[model samples]
Target: MMTDQPALPAPPSAEPADRLLADLIALRAAVLAEAGERLARLAPGGDAGAGIHNLANYLALRGHDLRPLQRRLMSRGLSSLGRLESRVLPTLDAVIEAAAALAGAPSPTAAPDPAAFFAGETRLAAEADRLLGEAPGHRRTRIMVTLPSEAAGDPGLVIDLARRGMDVARINCAHDGSIAWRAMAAHVRTASSLTGRRLTVLMDIAGPKIRTEAVATPDKKARIAAGDAIRFVAEGEPRPTADAPFSAVVSLPDLVTRLAVGDRVRYDDGKLEGVVESLAPGEAVVRVRRAKTGGVKLKSEKGLNLPDTALGLSPLTAKDENDLATVIECADMLGYSFVSRPEDLDLLEDALARRGATESRLGLVAKIERPEAVRNLPALIARASGRRPFGVMIARGDLAAEIGFERLAEMQEEILWICEAAGVPAVWATQVLEDLVKDGVPSRGEMTDAAMAARAECVMLNKGPEVGRAIELIDRLLSRMDGHVFKKTPTLRALASW
Candidate 1:
C-alpha cells in the first residue's frame, strides 16, 4: 500500500511464494534460536535441527506465533514492485508485512458489540457445565458425536468412539428438540457413571445462521476480490437463484448502522470475507475479498460476521431464545458460537441463571472465529473466570476463511497461547479429521495434521457416517506419535540435510 520509494530492483526470479517459504525454514531456526539453550533444549533434537521439531510443534498447536512466517511470505508481493526508495526488498519482505497485517488483523467474523462477546462466553461457560472438562489436567484428542434421541438411542456409535479413545460428545440443538437432548443427557450419565470415564456433551444451539434469503447459484469455487460490488437484501427477498450469494446479508436495520466503506464482512464464521463497498437506506453492498480453499460454495443458510463498527444486534437470537427454553442444560461444557461482546454473556447468565446455570460450574468454550472475537478474548476470559472457569475452541473452518486461509494456522496458535496463559482448556475444531472423514481416506498431510493436534486439549471432527472411524484415525495417528516419541518429533532438517 505504501508508495514506491525508488526504482525497482531485480527479484530472485520465478520461484514464486514457495521460495519465500523456503526462506522461512531458515527464519524458523533464527526465531527458535531466540528461545535460548534451556528452552532450546526443549527442541526434539539437541542441534539446530531442534528448531524444526519445535517449529513443527508450534505449527501443530496451530498457535499465532507462526504468523511471522506467513507475513514474511505475502509481503513478497511488494518486493516484486521493486525497491522502496533505495532499499532492496528483503527477499519477500512486503509479503511478510501483508501477511503480518492480514494474519494479525481481527477477524471479519466478529460481532461489533463487546457486550455480546462476553455474554456469549459467559453463556457458553454456563452451558459448559454440562459438557466435560479436560480430564483432570491432561489434554487428549477427543471424538465428538451426537447421541440418539432417548435412553434407547443407538449408542453403539458412542461406545465405539469411547473404546477408540473418544473423550467428548456433542448434542446439536438444531436437529431433535429437548426430548432428544434429555435422552442424550440421561444416556451420557449412564455411560460415564458406569465406565467411570468422564464424557462431556456440548450443547451447540444453532445460533443465528445468516444467509442471503433469496437463493443464489452455487459458484464452482468462488472469488471475491476487493473493489467489487455485490447485492444484499435489507430483510432478504426471494431470488431467482436457489440461493443468494453475497459477502453477507442483514435483516436488521440496527445491523446496517455498523457499516463503513472499507469494513470487511463475512458469512459462515468466515467461509466468506468481504468489504462493505457502499450502503443504501436498508441494504449495504459488501464485496467478497477472500476465500482460502476452493469448494462448491453457496449461501442457502446464513451465518454471522463483523460487517462494520456500529452493529447493535443482540447476540441472543430468537432461535437462541427458543433453544434455551428446552435446552438450558447442565453439561460438562458449553460452546457459544458467533460471540463478540460481554453483555451477551450477562444476558445468557440471566436466561439460564434461574435454572441456576450461571456459567459457574460449567466449562465455557468460546468459539473464536471472528476478528473482534480475538480482540475481545481477554475480557471474554475474565468474564468466564469470574463467571466460571472456561475453555476456548479456535473454530478453524470459518476462522481460516475469516482471517485468510493462509494465516489460519498462525491465528489459531495465537488463540491457544492466550488461552493456555489463562489456564483455559482449549479445543481445536473443524477439519482435524476432514480429509479422512470427508474423503474416507487420510492424506499424509492430514495424518500429520491430526498428530500435531494431539498437542491440544481436544481436536474436533465433523459428523460422518463413519464418524467413529474418524475418531479411530485420530487415535491411530496419535498412538503412532506416542510409540515413536523419539522419532515422532524428528527434525526434518536433520533427515533432509544429511
Candidate 2:
C-alpha cells in the first residue's frame, strides 16, 4: 500500500456538497465501467445508443436502491435530459478534482462524455424510425388505426384506410374470435399488396380483464343508482337473495377473494363508481357512489376496475395463451395488455419460444396501464431490450384510472422520458381524437391532443363509425406538426401563410 501524503492547499471554492457530488461521480464511473462490461456479455449485438443495456446493467449491479436518486433528480425538474447531462458531467468532474487534492491522490481524468450521455436520444430517434418506418410528404410519425369487425369483410374500407396514410392496422382480439382475426389480417395483407403501401398488422392480446359476467335480469340489464348496493359474487358462490335490486358476477372469480372492504371499484372506465362495503370468502358488496344523472345501466361484459386494492392476479390468463397462438401466426407485432412486471415479459417470451417464434422476428409492445407497471418501467424496458424490436404502448385509459385522474399528465411525460432513455418506440394510445371519431367532429382539446401525440412514434386511434375520417384528419395533422416538432425538441419551421 502507498503511504498517505501531506494535505495540499484547499481549492478556492470547495464545499461539503461539492465533495459528496465528486464521490458520487467517482462511484458512477466505476459502476458505468462495470455495467459496460456486463452489457457486452448480455447483448453483444445491442446498439450502443440503446441505453437499455446500460440501465439494465446498473440495475443488476445496484438493484433499485439508487432509484431514489433518480427520483430526486426528476423531482428537481430535470425534465430535459439534454440539459441534465450538460450540467451533471461538469459538476461531477469539479468534485473529483477537489477530492483528489484533499486526499493527495491523482484525480480521475476520464469522465462521462457527451456521446455517452446522449446515446439514448440518438438511438431513440433511430429505433422509432425503424419501427414506424418513413411516412410520405411531411410527417415522420405514423398512424395506427384500430380495425372494427366490419373491416374483416370490407376490403374497400381497408384499402381506403391504407390510401389515407394509415401505416398500421390494429386488430383487437378482445372483441373478435380467431375466425374474424384471420379475415381482418387477410384484408390488410391484400390492401398492402394492392396499394403498394407497407402497412403492419398488430394484434392485441386481451389479458386478464376483470369484467362483469352474465347478469340474470329480465331486461338483460340492471339500472344502478348512486347509494345503491350490489353484490359481486364469484362463479361458484350463490347470489345473495334480495341483494339490492341487481347483482353481477365478476369474470375472474379469484379477484373476489382478493378485494378488501373500502376498496374503490370502478365500472365502464370509471363512469360508474362504488366502494366495497363488505367482503366474504368469494363475494363482496359494493355501494355505488357515482353514476349518470338518472343512474347508469349495468350491462354484461362491461369492464370492472378495482383501483384501491393490491391485486394478486397475474397479467396472463388462459385466454391470452390461446390468443397468443393465433397472434404469433398472423401478427407482425403483439400488443400485451396489463403488463405490470418483468416476469410477465418472461411468460410472454416462454410462450413465444414454445411456439418457435424467435424474439428477433416478432415485435413485442408492452402496454403500460397499471401503477405497478409505471413504477417498474426502467426494469421492464431493460428486460425488453434482451429481445429485438421491442416497443411501449402508453395505455392511457386504464393507466389514468390506476394512478388516479390527477397524476395522469405527469405520469405520461415520465413514461415518455423512460421510453426515450431506453431508445424504444412509444405508441400514444387510447381515446385519441375520440369525439372526432365518434361524432364526426373534432373537439378543440382533442385536436391539440392529436398534435401532442405527433411526438410519439405512432398514434393509435380506436375504432369508430367515422374512423376513416379520423385517420385522414390524424394524417394531415401529424404531417403539419412533424416539421414543427421532433420529439421533445421544437424545430423552427416556417409557418404556412396559406
Candidate 3:
C-alpha cells in the first residue's frame, strides 16, 4: 500500500511469483545438496560401504514420495533397489539430510508458494504409501526346491509345480552338467509358457560336495579281529571273509589314532555300530557292535563323524573343485554350497564373474551348511553380499553335523534375523518337508517350521519320491500365509508411518 511505488498487478488465480521462485530454488538446492552428501557417503567409513539399506529410512525422513522418486530415478538411469540395497542404499540418508537443509535455507515451505512440484510429488508420495503397504517381497516367506537333472529334464513337472504353487525352483549343479541343466531349464520355460506364471528359478552350485575316497563293494560284512589292527584301507575291496554290519569311510589318521580297543564306532547314526578292536597307522580294526552282523553292506564315500576326532580332509571336495568350471545362467538366482570362509566366497564370486554375472542382477543364495561357514557367516554374507547381495540358505542337514544338532534350530533363527535386517532373502532347507515326502502328510512340527519359513523370503523343499504333492503342499502353505496374523509385519507399519 505504499504510495511511492506504482500499484502492482493482481495475482492470477493464486500464489505470488516470489514464493514460486523460492520453491524452485529450494527443490534444486535439495537435489544438489543431497547428491553432494550421498557422494560424500560413498567415501570411506560411510554406512553405504558397509552395505546398509537406507532407502526406506531416507524416504520417511525427507517427507518425499519414495516410490515416484525411485521410479523417476530408474527412468533416468538410476538403479531400482528392489533387493539390491547397496545400489540405491547410499543416497537415502543423504536425500533426507539435504531436504531438511534445503527447507531451512531458502525454505520451500517457509513462504506459501503455488505448490511447486506439490501435485506430482504428492501423487508419488501416495503411490509410495501403497507400495509400502506391499512390504518388501522378502516379507513373504519363500519356498525353495532342489531339482535333480532327471526332474529338470521334464518340462511338464516344472510347469505343473509352478501352477500348483512353487515360488522358486532350485537346480543343484553338483550332480549334473550344463547340458543336463539346460534340459531341465527347457522344461521350466515350457512350464512357464504353458501356465502363464512367473517362477523364480534358482541354481545351487556345488561349491564343495565333500565325500571320502571310493572303496570296492563287499558281499559279506568286514570284520577286524578283537586284537588285530588293520589300516583304513582307502582303496580296498571287501573280502569274502569280511563280516560287519555296515561300511565306513573311516577317518584315517585321526580316527585310527584316537580310538582305542573297546571304544565304539557308529556309522550313519547307528545303522551299524562296532567296537574298536585294534589300531595302527592310518588304520583301525573294529568288531561289530550288533549281535546279528554278518553280510552288512560296506561302501566307501560315506560320512563318518567321530565327534571326538578331527579329520585332516577339508570340507571342500575334489568334485567341488571340478564343478567350479561349470557355467550358470537362465536362472534368476544362485546358491554357493558349503561356503565357509571369506576366501570361499571370493572363489565363488570369481566363478560367478567368470560366468558373466558380475553385475549381480541374479540373486546369490549362500548355503551355510559347514560349521566353519556358520561361524564365519557374517563375513561370508558381507563379502558375497557385496557381489550379489542375495540371501542365505540354512542348509541344515550338513549344518546339524557341523554345529551340532542341538544348536541348529537356534542357528537357523539367527540366520533368519541377519538376512532380514540386511534385506537379503533366505531359504530354509533340509528335512523341512521330509515327512511330507516320506509319507503323504507333514508333521505338526514341520508345518510350524514351514509357516515360520514362509515368513522368511523362501522355504526350500527337497524332491521326495513324488514331487507333485510336494509342490502342492508347499503352495497351500504359502498361500495360507497371505492372510496370516501370526506376526506383526511391515505393511501395517507402512500404513501407519504417516
Better of 2 and 3 by lDDT: 2
Q: Can you write out model 2's per-residue Cα lDDT over 356-430, one digit (the tens) per residue?
A: 887576788899988888888876776777476788999988887676678988888777766764577889999
In Å, residue 472's CA in model 2 sits off its true spot by 1.2
lDDT of 1 by residue, 365-389 (tens): 6788766777777556555554555
Q: Best lDDT goes to which candidate?
A: 2
**Estimated TM-score per prediction?**
0.63, 0.79, 0.60
lDDT of 2 at 151: 89
Question: In model 2, what lDDT does residue 471 have?
Answer: 89
Residue-level lDDT of model 3, residues 371-394, one tens digit each, is 666666655644554455456778
Worst 10 residues of 2 by lDDT: 78-87
| Candidate 1 structure lDDT | 0.56
Preferred candidate (TM-score higher): 1 or 2? 2
Give the Å shift of residue 42 in candidate 3. Answer: 16
TM-score of 2: 0.79
